[model samples]
Target: MAERVYPKLIGARLRGQTSYRASFALQCVSSGLGQLVELGVILILFGRVTSLGGFSVTEVVLMYAIAGVGFGLADMVAGQLDELPAHIRTGTFDVVLMRPLGTLAQVMASDVHLRKIGRIVASLVALVWALAHNDIAWSPATALLVVLAPLSGAVIFSSIWVVANAVCFWLVEGQELANAVTYGSGSFTSYPATVYGPWLRRFFAFVVPGSFVAYYPGLALLGRPDPLGGPALLGWVSPLVAVATAAVAGLVWRFAVRHYRGTGS
Candidate 1:
């Protein structure tokens, strides 16, 4: 059912945005430029430093593009949950509950923000450049991983975004922190996860598990060993991590819905 419904919802959104073609195009351009500028920062830094942690510039770019694609995908979909506060405040969410559709699906499908396609485009550009610049030994596993990494990461990011929006049920004011966690996870995962201190790395890896999506897989993919200690096997754990986080998010959402009382707006 989701497979059938999601595309139609997104298509409707695309048509709506298409009505204002110029505005949509500009947003896409700006998003691409923003990603490019970030890539420039990494390039400039690499000019002075040969590598970060144990990974070289090209390998890092691969990690960046992977995480970028993941988050861009999530932001294009679940990032719509950022508006939950407005929905609750204005009593719009009451209608959401009254509808026959699943509340989570409705919330995610509410805004098919096409502007994020720019970030995805930029990620693809960076990904192609990285592949060209770095000579990664390609094999069946690596080929499969390339598809799995971003896909698993996108699901993880969307789950985190859902959890963040679920908090709006009670803590109506602290939305920025949730937004930070969503966008910041992208930044945190884009680089070598081992570069950070043990505590910070543990927080993202065990607590949030963002590192599993790209950084660990990146190490395995690039054939570089992890500097901070852990089983290298964790690299392939993206699917498991995605399942865990998403399950937790689902439980939290269920709890939130039960506790909800109409805002009376």
Candidate 2:
């Protein structure tokens, strides 16, 4: 069963992506170049300014590593961010629904973006360099958290991705709105939330839930305190947030699939 499903998923992606090799290559280059530019901007900031909001340049590099790995893994495993609406509009969802597997599983497993592997490799290398350059007091427990952070972060981002795609069942335009939460959350979390104002930090903690993924745990990892002096326990909440987000996203996905089948879209 695993053999069958794995190849089916991989083959689907190869066939789909073969039609636009030039576009796919361009997107990979664009993503890498964009990250390089952002890194350059950070270097410029750190060249003049010492640190921003208690986060050193190295610390921010760690945060970027965490965020990049999280976002990259999510996009690689689940690249159907824009496919749900297209499936609905074209009635391709019927084919998914007809599959013996769960509709959500089928939809999610249908495509894998191989270009994201470049991003993942790049982030991993940056993370290693950042770890070597920074002042991290690694013990048994801290080491565990460092490893778990990316796993939790990946799950959290994938949950956001699932929610984004599921919104397509309601309306095509909903996908755009969902980007505010999914992609915007990633962009915001890439920087230390402490750099943001009070209301923005609270929004990340309470509303969007991106704070738990990296910013808080990153503070703990870096042996720093939150400038707002928020609860230190927020760092430990990463796994809980990941599990909860996945559960909620799973329920939302189920409902969306049901709605799609019932409404014939």
Candidate 3:
């Protein structure tokens, strides 16, 4: 028999979630409301301070938007990483592996939370509002670069989740560590990266690659020169960090599958 993974599984999950219209609608509204509170915080912060680490209120809002959209997309589509331990403990993981489809694909597509669409829409509105306040000089090149920022943010965050979940093949405690990277990084990135000290900022940028997703691409889009004196090439390369992280994540996922030890075996 011939079988492929990912698409079928994702379709299955999407259909299952959409089946409950009332629950899904409530989820969407709740997610939107939650993001509204985040926007309110930004407004309060800006009210108190003129700028954050040289990031204008608009740039700070852009960071929030990029991080928000990325997080909402990841949670909606790939948030199943949260349930790995329970699956393993219950021996349900065996059923997933029994399928001809890839184990990671099946696990990832196990759930799709559609309410994130509301959050994503909210992020876009925030981004647009930021642009209106601090209009950047428009060029075709910069325009496309700005657009890619959020996409890169999404990929980076998803990759972090992948690595975090991969550790579950060894440790049940992997879940907590994973949250620090996924949730912590998302919360941290929502602010201006420059607000952190030099070492911390560099770690997020070059080490973890969070900087590429929000800060660097933001600079390109907002027409702000790089504070680190990064060359012009860095602007174009911001989006590529997401692709690179995703590629590395694929390798990590393969390793986790290879290292799999059957539950209670």
Candidate 4:
């Protein structure tokens, strides 16, 4: 039942967004431009320095591209989970719970921002440019990593979104906290992990595991060694990291839902 219902729900939302073609187009353009400004910052920084955290401009851009694509897709799909707090505060979550559909699925399907595809498109362009500029050692494994990196990265990011936002079950005001983790991770993952201090690197790399989203995979694609002394195989483990993160997120979400006692309004 969910298999059939989920697609229809998403399709309905997609159609609704497209119904106002001009507004949708403008939104997409604005989103794309906004993302480009961030990319421009990276480029501008490289103009002065030869490298950041030991990575060349092209290499850093690859990290940005991978993270951007993953985050753009995750944001489009699961970013609406941020509204969980608002729903709880206003008691709309009770209606959500009463629905036949699963609470998480319904929340995810509630808002599909197709405008965020602009970011994905811009990231793909950057990916192409980065690929053209880099000296990658092409192989079947490398080719496969290129394809799976963004997908696995998306899963990793979406799981973080779910896990972080689940705090709303206990702290209704936790939206800001969740945003800090979700958006902060996106920004952090867009650069070399080596750029961060030792303690901070370990936190984002192991605690949040943002390194798997782009940094390690970018290393694999570029055929570069981990400067921080991680094993070469870590780059290929993004899918594994994604699966593990998603499992943990599922457990957290279930626990949070079970703990919910409603707003009592």
Candidate 5:
């Protein structure tokens, strides 16, 4: 049954990941330190001014924390998409297709990095710091949205990675450029969307849905006014964006798999 299969695959991955303790530990530390360094930039920017592009230090940090944990969770699971090109290039994708498991689930569960816990922890610390200073009303709905935001964020990011990697089926050499969507957007969502021009913001909002991944959901959570002056209600659309993105990605991935005629390697 799928219930038993998913856990067995993921558990096996966790065990294999833990087999190399030193490497795992180093990655964890580095992941934490890297996030701190990004936070340091925000702190330094705030030291010079009250806010950046209308987002206060706490707000910006909150945005970063929400985005970081969301992206980190996505990366820990679906980062294997990055290796899809390699799988196809090496003719291993054929083997993957032959397996009893679903290709998407198998690829998603393939690279479960425990080091991403470092990024999650760093985000948690920042969230705590942000909550310490904010005047948020802890209403029941607010509580529910706060809980929903990060989980939806994970799905949003995972879908981005999935759709981007599906290109590997068409481009045999692989598209190294897909990082601009996944990794690049992770960096982009940490700041308020207002800092960018209408074109850039629209591209992210309409095309990639990066706005829903963190910025918009964050706007609603903090009860802060949108810098671009959109309806505050846009924040609630984050879950819809996540679901829609995943649906499209699933369709693309399935179509790509159907079309993949392995290179005569």
Candidate 6:
């Protein structure tokens, strides 16, 4: 039942957005351009230096592409969770709760912004360009990692969105905090983990685990050894990290939902 219903829900939202064709197109262009600007910054920086933290311009672009696509997809799908506080404040959450669908499912499917695909498209182009420019040893494993890396990164990012936004159930004003963590993770993961200081790298790696989103998989894709001396096998552990993060997010979300007592308005 959910299999059919979720698609219908998403389809309805997609149709509504497409109804404003010109606006939709403009929004997509704007979104893609904005994302490209970030990539441009990396290129400009590399113009002055040959390498950053032992990574070339192309290698850093690979990281950016993976992280950008992951975050873009997550933002399109689960970013609506940021509005949970507004729904709670306006008492519309009661209506959401009365629906037959799972709260998270309905909330996620409520607003599917197709404009965010622009960011994904921009990053995908970069991914192809990076793959072409890099010295990759093509193999069955390498091919599989290339395909799975972005997807696993998406799951990792989406789980971060869920866990961070779940705080809204307790602190309706927690959106800023959640945005800091979620968007911050995206920004942090857009470069090689080696670029950052050890403390920042460790924080993201252990506390938030954003490193799994791009940096590790990127190492595997590029056939580069970890500059930090971590095992090469860590590159392939993104799927495991994504699954673990998602499980933890599920628990936090459920706990938050159960603790909700409404605003009593």
Candidate 3 positional error at 205, Å:
1.4
lDDT of 1 by residue, 143-216 (tens): 88888989899999999898878888987765887888888888899888868888988888888888987898
Tell me each candidate's TM-score: 0.94, 0.88, 0.92, 0.98, 0.95, 0.97
How high is the lDDT of residue 34 in model 6? 89
Model 6 C-alpha lDDT per residue in residues 140-246, reported as the tens digit of each score:
99899888888888898999999998888888888899999999999999999998999999999988999999999999999889999989999999999989999
Pairwise lDDT winner, candidates 1 and 4: 4
Model 5 has how many clashing residue pairs? 0
* Rank ordering of all candidates by lDDT, starting from the highest: 4, 6, 1, 5, 2, 3
- Candidate 4 lDDT, 1-265, residue by residue in tens: 9899999999999999999999999999888888899999999999899999999999999999999999999999998998999999899999988978888889999999899999999999999899899999989998899889999999999999999999999999999999999999999999999999999899999999899999999999998899999999999999999999999999999999888999887
Highest-TM-score candidate: 4
Candidate 2, residues 1-265: lDDT per residue as tens digits? 7558868777877778766989877767776666666667778899999997778899898888888888888877776766777788878888877767777777767787877766777777778888898888899877888888888988998998888778878876577777777888878878888788889888877777888778888888888777878788877679888999999999999887776643454
Q: Candidate 6 clashing pairs?
A: none
lDDT string for model 5 (107-221, tens) is: 8777687788888888878877876787787889877887778888899899999988898899876567777788877888888898788998998888988888778888888
Worst 10 residues of 4 by lDDT: 96-105
Instruction: For residues 1-265, write the lDDT of model 3, one tens digit per residue.
Output: 2254566766777788778999988888888888978989988988999988887788889878877888788877678788987787677888887877777767777777777888888888888887777778889886786677787788888888888888877886578887877787787788877688888887777777887777777777777787777775666786678889999999998988787886683
Local distance difference test, per candidate? Answer: 0.87, 0.80, 0.79, 0.94, 0.85, 0.92
Question: Worst lDDT window (10 residues) for model 5?
Answer: 172-181
Instruction: Please report how far candidate 1 places residue 144 from its true position, in Å.
Output: 0.7
Between prediction 1 and prediction 6, which has the larger lDDT? 6
Candidate that would win on lDDT: 4
When summed lDDT is taken over every stretch of 10 residues in candidate 6, the lowest stretch is: 256-265
Q: How well does model 6 score by local distance difference test?
A: 0.92
